[model samples]
Target chain A: MKKIIALLLAAAMMVVAAGCGGEQSASSGSGSGSGGKQITMGFSQIGAESEWRTANTESIKQAAKDAGINLQFSDAQQKQENQIKAIRSFIAQGVDIIAFVPIVETGWDTVLKEAKDAKIPVIVVDRDVKVSDDSLYVAKIGTDSVKEGNNVFKWIDEYMAKEKKTPRDGGSQYNVVVLEGTVGSSVAIRRQEGFKDAMAKSANAGKYNLLASQTGEFTRQKGQEVMESFLKSYGPKIDILFAHNDDMALGAIQAIEKAGLKPGKDITIISIDGVKGMFQAMIDGKANCTVECNPLQGPLLMETAKKILAGEKVEKLVYVDEGVFPADVAAKTLPERKY
Target chain B: MDMLKKFAGSSLFLPVVALLVLLVFNTIFVDGFLSIQLTEDGRLYGRLVDILNRSCSLIILALGMTFVIATSGIDISVGAVVAISAAVVCTMIGGRGDGVAQMPMALAVLAAIGVGVLCGMWNGLLVAKFKIQAVVATLILMTAGRGVAQLMTEGQIITVYYKPFEYIAGFLPGMPLPTNIFIALAMVLLVAVLMKKTSIGLFVQSVGINATAARYAGINVTLVIFLVYAFSGLCAGVSGLIESSLIRAADANNAGLNMEMDAILAVALGGTLLSGGKFYIGGSVIGAITIQTLTTTMYALGVSADQLPVVKAIAVVIICLIQSKKAQEMFDAWKARRMSKQNGKKTSVDGKVAEQA
Candidate 1:
């Protein structure tokens, strides 16, 4: 009986191993059978934590299909360890290229070094990584948050000038309040610095006084609460409201309406991240403007990957082009927004 | 004086005093903090109203948490359960372009609550039947519930545009206050009656005190534990409804995020023992209000967002110290020592007078 059981166990192991081997060979065969050499790329995503992320993932998947690249995808579910595991597995699978949206800025040196040893070029997408050696990854593709922030104040200056709403030489000061994003985040810190820089450089810099700035934690609820207190403290004296992201601006709009004041008219509302909800708010005349932080980087990433595989020189830093969406254009552009 | 002492000795005392202290600080430091104005739409608009309005959900969560803690069990899954409930309701009432609910509002709400109760039953099964640790059992749901919610929403944040649906968190026609305040009040009253009129409360206390002893006393320990968790799920469901309605969207990632910690903290601030037995619903309600008031005060003062948590922690520590029984006992001992010293001084004075005579 013992000998029979051992034979059965050995037969089961052979069948499982044969199944895996068949799958491996079939995948490789299909990869080579395509019109030309198909580039096999493994991409690790951070997770679908927000609409922006989901749209970003969709763009990558669709782009990979359009580019005829064999894409091996894994979701890290917002964990760095999971991302590292995915990268190691991709190395074992010996994919031609590896790309990932690093969940954090640090702790990728070892795994990335392993990928380099395997001769698999790595592309860092969306969020960046801080590896000891820059050669660990071939390229980084993401939006410049500081530039997005600078664009916010620049557009505000242009809008005010166009509307002739800029404060006169001796007119009452324009009190501005800011609804910041999650504290200590890189995006938040950079955006704030950029805004401050532009504000100082603006033509009417001295005419604007910063009434208050507080963190909204990048949520609608906290944004509404903080906005409510701001209204109570500063009242209708506030002429402008700047939110670090669209969600908080949407919340502030609700609070503004509840306080019996018109949002865009009473307080010019400007925020970052041109999300669909923000566009809707703009179309409704609740918000004024949003500086776009584009998440659709699929095509750019594919082009870069093709360039890298062809032994072509690619820029180490690649930034996707973004635009500013004002209230007047929101109605026309809302339909085209994929996010 | 005796009545004051009795009032001070009650479980509700510390929470109430904490709330009052926050309110008083705001009144003194924040401009127009105590003033309430009527909006053109006839709703009350002010920071005070915001505190009450926002705290309603936390109060409801704390109410349910109170019962679960009284059974010596924690429901860390309530936050995730809130996300699940929100997802269920929002999806069932699909986001049609015409802004119409796919299903009846009442039916959608009931379905959400039903799903929550089902989740609770799963946790209860693991903890009560499988003899799993409560934290581990609830942690399973805590981790998986958000994933389940994400699946239900198809990884999208479902925004409900149905105008009538807004009344869950917003004001009804001509209403002076938010609907959530009334919902919270009704829940508190319902739970208060349940504890006062039924022997279920006693059963829960017995089970919490000692399950072995409770079983010997003819108490259905398993049923008691199961029911409390189910009740917690119910509270989470109602809270989910209020929260989703506030934003008019069901955010699977952010809805009720870290709410379990807030609920647990409120329970602790209410002077409830972590090792459960007797509990007070009113104390928890006051505790919830106090926390919201603290948040509002921080915002009112315009504290930097990065430093807000640190300031909040300091406030919570001060309140907890004030509520600590050991601190109170120590104070009493010090007072007694001073009283004895005074009496000794008086006797010595009399002895000197007698010697002079």
Candidate 2:
């Protein structure tokens, strides 16, 4: 008990010291305001996991450098604890504005409260953190994962029609093998629910169906393995492959190739996250379609940061632009791609 | 009935029975489940090869665990050891480079093994020196070791770029077989030779059977305990190397996570006495395959995720009962009565003949 108390006292002291230091930094911040004045922008990333994350990190770094803003970067590494720690650190840093990609929907009450306590405006990007009150964040900028799923299905309907294959329910439904994202993740859960809802509500209900839905954890290997099993147990049964993310979709494609089968021609593959790999997959005619989930949050976040720091009213939610891209256009759009 | 009553040394029967039941159940209830494809591609897709690949790591974990269990010690930290080795290999080795540039892989492998040994030694010191329970000591290292692995890579996966390291989990030339499977098989034979063909194996078993008796017999009990944990670390280090190669990246959180459960379950199902004494290398190998097959089939048949634990629990429970005292007693008593009845008739006849004489 004494040891715990001592630890708590130490932690309290650290927090107070950090808070004081943050105040000092905020007073002498460096960022580009209206007249080229130095300002500060705090950014928190949802920890690194893959090449995509590295790209994200680089994008933000370059953005911060080019914008001449003092970027207070925090790598959460996909942990709520670490993310919370970073947020608290940002609060102590007292940057003019804050931006972060939330790892999960919940568990932001305490840290957001800290941000609120610090009187700093927060901008949400990539992923949204669930809060009881929307007043917590100044603006939220991200793609609609549900609409992404809808777009995939919409393309699938056209693809199936061109293939002249009757849906399993005799043109009423098409059986789908769904590779879901991590369980309890907002993207995975919502995207799955959204796709299910869209498929059910589509005009040709018999043209869309669900065979099996499993968590691939948004990895290529898991996606490949799951796809293989689906092929085994439900051979000739799965008509379409629906992945919650591009990574799993890519994995499924690998599994398909390993099986000595063509992916797009045999089984329709549709996914979100218009990553370069997905575009390459489209260009090679492996993946059928993709829904773009923009990763570049610099401009949108910067805009929100400026507004919040300037004491101007910003919209509570800012849905970023997102749309479906067919394989036909992949080659044409490859050069213009920035992600 | 009397013939059916024998089960003392038999360990494979229950696990096999449960496995068969699950297979049959799936064949019946799961839709299109009988679509059993015998093609090489089909089996490969079904995880036959992947399971074999995973078998090497599992066997290493089991081999290490065997000595630990034989000495009445347990190490829950092998899972975290996997993460540590993977991170070391990925970050230290500099990933996917030429032979000279791939020095980090070799260094990482050595570091991982060294680290694993150190972890085992730490556990050993706690159990042999400070008299801590093996379970508690290992559990502490389990959490802390994972924390260490996460700290090493800063929670980022460093993708391996070297082709040589890829061959660790990739394939053997021309055989279309994973290299890890062969490695695991070689380790199994090595473990078997170590335990059965050597005095050290007997010494460990004797110590486990009765530590006091072993001590009176002049056996160094503490040394044996320490040896067991260190051996466990070596096994975990090998497993970590294979696993890192498979993913081509050192993901601290996911690599070798929940592996301890699989290893423990494999050891238990192998009928190795968890309390200590007598290792079953063959049984452990079979147990690993059986569990892998069951997992593969379950996922293949579209088993609902919510009900996996329940099914696993029920299967485990049934297997335990089949090999339990209650079931054995019922069979034993029946056999005893039948044998006694036949013997009574024979003895009466013999007695009558003796009276006539």
Candidate that would win on lDDT: 1
Give the per-residue lDDT digits (tens) of candidate 2, residues B117-169.
88778888888878899889889989988889988887555556566676787
Off by over 4 Å in 1: A1-50, A57-99, A114-121, A166-171, A302-314, B1-5, B333-357
True interface contacts reproduced, per candidate: 0.79, 0.34
Question: Each candidate's DockQ score against the native complex?
Answer: 0.54, 0.27
Native-referenced Cα lDDT, model 2: 0.73
Q: Report the C-alpha lDDT of model 1 over B241-349, residue by residue, as the tens digit.
A: 9998888888898899999999998999888898999887898898898888998899999888888999999999988887888987998898778666766777556
The CA lDDT of each predicted structure is: 0.87, 0.73
In angstroms, the error of model 1 at A136 is 2.7
Q: What is the TM-score of each predicted model, taking all chains together? A: 0.87, 0.76
